[model samples]
Structures are given as structure tokens and as C-alpha cells.
Target: MLSNRYFTNGIDIYFDNVCGSMLDAVLNMTNHGRIAVCGMVSQQRLSQPEGIYNLFNLVIKSITMKGFLQSGYLHLFPMFLEDVVRFYKQGKIIYLEDVNEGLESSPIAFAGLFSGRNLGKQVICVARE
Candidate 1:
């Protein structure tokens, strides 16, 4: 059982990445909350995704849940890139890259993502451009 202090007032918005127990916990703590379902890394390799016991809370609390895909927003790429470049140039953003030296290391780099072995965005440098 979670402490009352954990959600005494309830959450307004939740950005979900790892779904499963964490999702369940959020569900129980939400009150008319808005949940942005980003990624479900927790259920990626599972044969069957775990069921959420607190799903009924969504109805009870009148929550809003939405899923998004980056590809779906490709039309806004130019705007996104402009903002990112402006931020980067203005020293407002710091980018991190976990780069693998050769094409041979591509598999390892891909696997590292799922295992949390990569520290930053994994990149396989086939040949430096």
C-alpha cells in the first residue's frame, strides 16, 4: 500500500515511459489526470504485457490518456529542427551521444538500448561523415 502523502492531492499530469507496475501506481494516484503514453520499455520483451490492476481508476477519476509517435509528427520536423538548432547554438541544450566505432558494433549498440547499457543516444558510426 502506498502512503496517503504519496497522492494526497493527486497528480495533474503524468508522462509515462516504462509501463507496468509504474503505470499501475500512476493510475491509482491520478485525479482527473492527463497521461501521455510515450514508450512501454517494460513490456517490450515480455511474452504478455502485465495487466494494470488500477485501470478502473482511469474511469473513476476521469483521466485522459494519449499515445504519440515521433514519426506522426514528421511534418513538423523543420520547425522542430529549427528550435533545436537555435537552442543548441544558444547553449540552452546539451546533446549526448554514445557512439560505436564501426558497423560491426551496430548489433551491440542496438542491444545496449534495451538493456540500459548505453549511457546516451546510441550511434553506430559506419564511417565518420
Candidate 2:
């Protein structure tokens, strides 16, 4: 779900609609509120077409939106690795992966990612890298 709210400076935020509509959640925001964009559930193909995002609200709010991914910070991989390891060792982190053996299953594994069929990360194990 996507929503818009106005603070001192109007900033709009889009929330994942897994549990409820993000659009409804942000309508009551005050001034100078901040929004962090992580993922989009409105992109899903569901029984109903999701509501359109209010671009006008964003423009009026002067909202600042930002997104981040691991690949974008490849240079900081070492630091990320260390932080992740500590969290993992503390049992504060969990991961899921779908591993397919043999090169023959590579295509299937790749397809899973595009289809969102794989429960977690999809990995293909080839005899050679």
C-alpha cells in the first residue's frame, strides 16, 4: 500500500501492504515526517488493482525518498560481513536459501527467482564455478 502525509515539509511514504493498507496509515502524518522506501506490495498481481500513488501529495510535501541495496555498497562489503556475522552468531539473524544441484537445474533455480516461487535465495550448485 502507498500513502501520503503532510508535515511541516510534506513527505510521502509508501508502506508494504502485507497486513493493511499503507495508504490509510500515512494519511494522518504531521509535518516534517520522513519516509523510507524499502519494498512495494502494490506491484503484486492480486485479485484487485491497487490504488494509484498520489504524486501530487509527494510534490506538495517535499518528501525525501531513498532506497538501498547490498550491491550498491559493494565497497562496504567487508563491514557488512562483519556486522552480519556478529548478528548471526548472536542468533539475531536468520536466512533461507533454495539450493539446486547440478548445472541442469540452473535454469529452474533462476526461474524461481523471477517467479517468486523460491522461498528464499536461490542458488545453483555447479561442479565448477
Candidate 3:
């Protein structure tokens, strides 16, 4: 898999939004790694989720994992939005979106987010502006 190939020497930092298999795979390959856990979409629908086996590696590798909620940092939204707008106007940022037309395609588009079928951000357009 990508983790086995890319993390041969281990990673310094990892931004983890998808927890489950990917997180389990990364735990084994972390060397003083700092993991910022934002979401756990992988385990959302599971009644019984798989347990991480290599959690002991955290102690061995001195890894740090922290979870955060964006709602808690609502105060920073203006600053964040400003930076995003600046980057977008300066052509420093690229937005890649898989847009599904109409409400009928919303289910497929939303499901694609978890399946990795969408390349970047997935958007469901009910109407054009």
C-alpha cells in the first residue's frame, strides 16, 4: 500500500482525518510522529470497529496524537477565510472539486467522500447560480 512504500523511514508529522485502516497503518510507521486527528469517517457506519494493534508503537516511537474540532476554533474563521481568499486571488491555491449535478446525485457524491472516489472536494449542486 502507499503507507508501506512511502513511510519506509517513518513520517515526522501526519494530518489524519480518516481514522481506521489508514490510521492503523500509519501508527506502525511513525517515528516521533505528530498526528493531528480531525475526523474518523471510516468508523462512522461500523457497529464494531477494528481495534488498532500497533498502538504500543506510540510509546516506542514517542508519537503524539491529538484530536480537534473545528467548531471550537470558530473565532479563527475570519482569519482563515481571509488567508484562503488571498491565496485564491493570488493564484497560489487550486480548488479541485467533483461536482454532482442535482439532488438526485447527492447520495453518491457524499458516499464518494468515504470511498476515495472523489479526487478533492465533492460538491452537490442542486441549482446553478
User: RMSD for each model, in Å, please?
Assistant: 7.4, 10.7, 4.9
lDDT value, residue 5 of candidate 2:
23
Candidate 2 C-alpha error for residue 33, in Å = 19
Q: For residues 1-129, what per-residue lDDT tens digits would candidate 2 score against the true structure?
A: 112222343323433222124443454344444455555444454566556354354456565445555367799989989999999999976545778999999887776554345544578878765
**Per-residue CA lDDT of candidate 3, range 1-129, in tens?**
545675566656777766777677778765778889998876787789757787998899899999999899999999999999999999977545789999999998888766445544688899999
| Candidate 1 local lDDT, 15-117, one digit each (tens) | 7766777678778665678999988876799798888888998899898989997779999999999998999999977445889999999998888766445
Backbone clash pairs for candidate 3 read none
Candidate 3 segments whose C-alpha is farther than 4 A from its true place = 7-9, 81-112, 115-129
lDDT of 1: 0.76
Lowest-lDDT window of 10 residues in candidate 2? 1-10
Which 10 consecutive residues of model 1 have the lowest summed lDDT?
1-10
| Cα lDDT computed for each candidate against the true fold | 0.76, 0.53, 0.77
Each candidate's TM vs. the true structure? 0.54, 0.40, 0.61
- For model 2, the local distance difference test gives 0.53
